[model samples]
Target: MKHITFYLDFISPYAYLAFEKLPAALEGVSHSVTYQPILFAGLLKHHGQLGPAEIPGKREWTYRQVLWQAHEHGIPMQMPSAHPFNPLALLRLAIACGPNRFVCETIFRHAWRGGADAADAARVQALQQQLAPGRDPASDDVKNALKQATNDAIARGLFGVPTFAVDDKLFWGFDALSMLRAYLLGDAWFATTWDAATRPTSALVRPARG
Candidate 1:
């Protein structure tokens, strides 16, 4: 059976949005999804990249864009009280649940839709117990598993959450879902290269400051 690897982090609203829509988007397509929880903060640090929320203008635009995308997708979304909240416990819990999709979705909703503080260890443990009774989020195995997953993601050239990998091709961002779907459907355009000479220049290039 064919499968796609979904690398995600609960701290990302975009990841939550992607989790909500991907199943339906791929309906009727014969492919399975493997959810891999990773430390998004680790990825950012490894790549020396600033998240959208770290930038002034981009932060505001990202919040607006996320809400717009959620509305368009008819999904409920509420920003958590904190941005870049610690997701160590959450990631460990997800791994404890054996990387289950339902568990992942529940946690994603708790943070993004329910506006819950996923950084709280106690709260995260409670949620994990609810989904996987008797599972220990603090277990060494679970902790190591999450770390390994993050390392594996970094090794695969993933610097963002909600990244979908089908075979060797990797698609990042929730907005890339359409392209992924088209590729899954065997679209030939994806394999064709565009002629740079025929490309038109942008009409809105900003002038350099004096």
Candidate 2:
């Protein structure tokens, strides 16, 4: 059995795409996914990295690239020009996955498939009603859980959403998801195909400080 911890926030389109495709990526594999919601903007700031929207060139290239990839992979996506960066409501729904999983999956589906903002109070509340009636958005437990999840993210070295930690391995970005897929599909399948340049060590490692 394998376990993959998926740290995600509702703010990233890449996160949405990854969540939508993860089921197929894990097909036939004995695995469990734990969703941890975090503040992506803070994560980027901590690492001295720019968010996708802040990087002019990268942001432009990303939109085109994502569209192309979506076409090729049959994944539906639309990069919201004025996308909101809040993840509070989304995190609440995620942490509510205490005894059941369908609620979490439903939220992901609304955000990823419907292109809805999972963080919005109105949007999330409506979705909650449709999927799981009696699950009030204003509930005390839900509110507390969301706050705790956000705080937990800060403690976990998480600065972004859609950050996946499989066992001791941490991976970020949609571009690296294929690497995760390869890892889960037995050693032989991914060993030869996995690219080393994208690995965590290679991606972030730099010269020592003086």
TM-score per candidate: 0.87, 0.70
Off by over 4 Å in 2: 96-101, 112-122, 132-144, 154-156, 185-210
Give the best candidate by lDDT: 1
The C-alpha lDDT values of all candidates are 0.84, 0.66
lDDT of 1 by residue, 1-210 (tens): 467999999889899999999988887777888999998988999987788899999999999999999999999998887887888777777887777788888888878876666677677767866887345778888888888889999999898988999987788999988878887888887667323433787789766556
Residue 65 of model 1 has an lDDT of: 97
Residue 149 shift from truth in candidate 1, angstroms: 1.0
Q: Where's the lowest-lDDT run of ten residues in candidate 1?
A: 189-198
lDDT (tens digit, per residue) of candidate 2 on 70-120: 777788766543454565566555555441346556665566555445556
Instruction: Supply every candidate's count of residue pairs whose N, Cα or C atoms clash at under 3 angstroms.
Output: 0, 2
Candidate 1 regions with alpha-carbon error over 4 angstroms? 133-135, 194-210
